[model samples]
Target chain A: LAKTTQPISMDSYEGQEVNITCSHNNIATNDYITWYQQFPSQGPRFIIQGYKTKVTNEVASLFIPADRKSSTLSLPRVSLSDTAVYYCLVPNAGGTSYGKLTFGQGTILTVHP
Target chain B: EPEVTQTPSHQVTQMGQEVILRCVPISNHLYFYWYRQILGQKVEFLVSFYNNEISEKSEIFDDQFSVERPDGSNFTLKIRSTKLEDSAMYFCASSERSGLAGYNEQFFGPGTRLTVL
Candidate 1:
């Protein structure tokens, strides 16, 4: 699995846009970038996923550049409730590996008022 | 949205005793997994189950630990003899699988916090 490095923490004010970037310098072709958001006392939830370029969902957007070395997760109009730990994951390559995630020390996002 | 559910949201056990953590994954998902996070540490993978057998496991899942899908509806992890270090939050996850792609979005359950004394 490609190792991932992300900021330890970030801060944002309400109604501001927040962008968190994760670098996976050793990423392989078969690796896909997926993000998960985890709130206190709750399980991590899927936010968005992308192989390349840009993919957006109702909750967030993921942008992957051509080099595939790093990806950014963009959250629009953040609110205090958006404060949580965000994780970036790249699965190990195999035929039968169905989402066996190796989690890193996720980036903690604190949304301020 | 369909979600994974786990039993006994918190379990407190004595060291050297046995304990079991149970989970019911999303109804239609085929793959099951176990992960744990020590206090203030990153979540770590334990094991993955598919076709009623373990497909992969990490070094942390030593001989003292075992996983079983005893029946259709439940998956359980049993620790033969718990140690103090075994205390952590255990999370169960499941995902649907198909084709040659080795990945799927896994849905996690609210973890069971195991406290060993």
Candidate 2:
């Protein structure tokens, strides 16, 4: 697993779009960017993932540049319930990789009223 | 809406005592993992199990730590001799194996908070 850095906290309002950026300068070629959302007292939930370029899901979008040193998770139309810590992971995208997640200090997204 | 389930949301035991944390992974998922987080620290992986065998483990998974899938639906992490430093929130996760390619999303269960005295 590659080391990642993300914001300590972020504030947003309901109905707004929020972007959380994570930096992983040493990410390997085989690594893929993956994001997860975790609410209080709950396990982290998968949000989005991408190898390069852009990937969008019903919940969020992942934007990765050619360098892949960093990636951004875009959550549109955020709600108060979206208040949770978001984690960025560069999981080895292939070949015998299991869920050995090394969670960093996630970005806590606070969506207020 | 399938979810992994963990038992005894909270467990309190004395140091040197054996403790077992139980989890029921999603029915169809083939890969299972165990991770723990101290009160204010990041989550750390303990071990990963598949095909009823240990695939990978972290340095934290020392001699005292073990994982077992006793039945069809249950995956258990057992600490042979718990320690004060072992008190933490332990999480269980399962993922569906999709070939050898990457990008399999792991589904996690509500964690078990283990308190060692």
Candidate 3:
């Protein structure tokens, strides 16, 4: 499994864009970067995922560099309800250890009015 | 949207007693998983089940913990003897498939908060 590092916390204002970066220096070639969002007392929700380059969805966008060592989750025009803890995971999606998600101390994004 | 659902949103149990956490995953999902999060801590994987058997488990899932898909729709996690450390929010997740190249997005339930006293 690859280890990931992210900012402990981030502050954003309503209608502003927020970007959370994750560092996975040891990520494998086949590893795909997946992001999840969790509000207080709720389960984590899938946000976006990408292997390389940029992948955009209605909720968020993921940008992966050529090296695949790091990825960024960009949330556009954030709102107060968008405040949550965001996790960047590299799941063991294949082989004997398939579909086990290893979550880290994710970045807590606090949206201010 | 078809989402995973868990029963007994909150459970309070005494130490040395048995407790069962139940979940009903999305009807079409094939892979099931259990994870827990201690207050102010990161989420930790406990176990994963597929094909009526366990596919993988973490060290946190000890002998006291067991998983069963006793019926077509229900998946349960049983703790024979609960301890104080067992207190946490247990989450159930499921996915339609596995593998990096395929659709492996795991959808999680709201979670069951278990408190041991």
List model 2 lDDT by residue over A1-113, tens digit each. 57899999999999999999999999988887888888887788888788899999899988999999999999999999999999998866566666567678899899999
Candidate 3 colliding pairs, count: 0
lDDT of 1: 0.90
Q: How far does residue A60 in candidate 2 sit from its true spot (Å)? A: 0.7
| i-RMSD of model 2 (Å, 1 decimal) | 2.3
Residue A40, model 3: Cα distance from true site in angstroms: 0.5
Query: Global lDDT for candidate 3?
Result: 0.92
On lDDT, the stronger of 1 and 2 is: 1
How are the candidates ranked when ordered by DockQ, highest leading? 3, 2, 1
Q: Which tens-of-lDDT digit does each residue in A1-108 have in candidate 1?
A: 789999999999999999999999999888889899988877788898888999999999999999999999999999999999999998765555656788899999
DockQ of all models, two decimals each: 0.58, 0.63, 0.67
By summed lDDT, which 10 consecutive residues of candidate 3 chain B come out lowest? B97-106
Could you give candidate 3's per-residue lDDT for residues A23-110 as a string of tens digits? Answer: 9999877788999999999999989888899999999999999998999999999999999999999865455666888899999999
For residue A59, model 2's alpha carbon misses the true position, in angstroms, by 0.8
lDDT of 2 by residue, B86-106 (tens): 999999999997324665488
Task: Name the Cα RMSD for model 1.
Answer: 1.4
Residue pairs clashing in model 3 are none
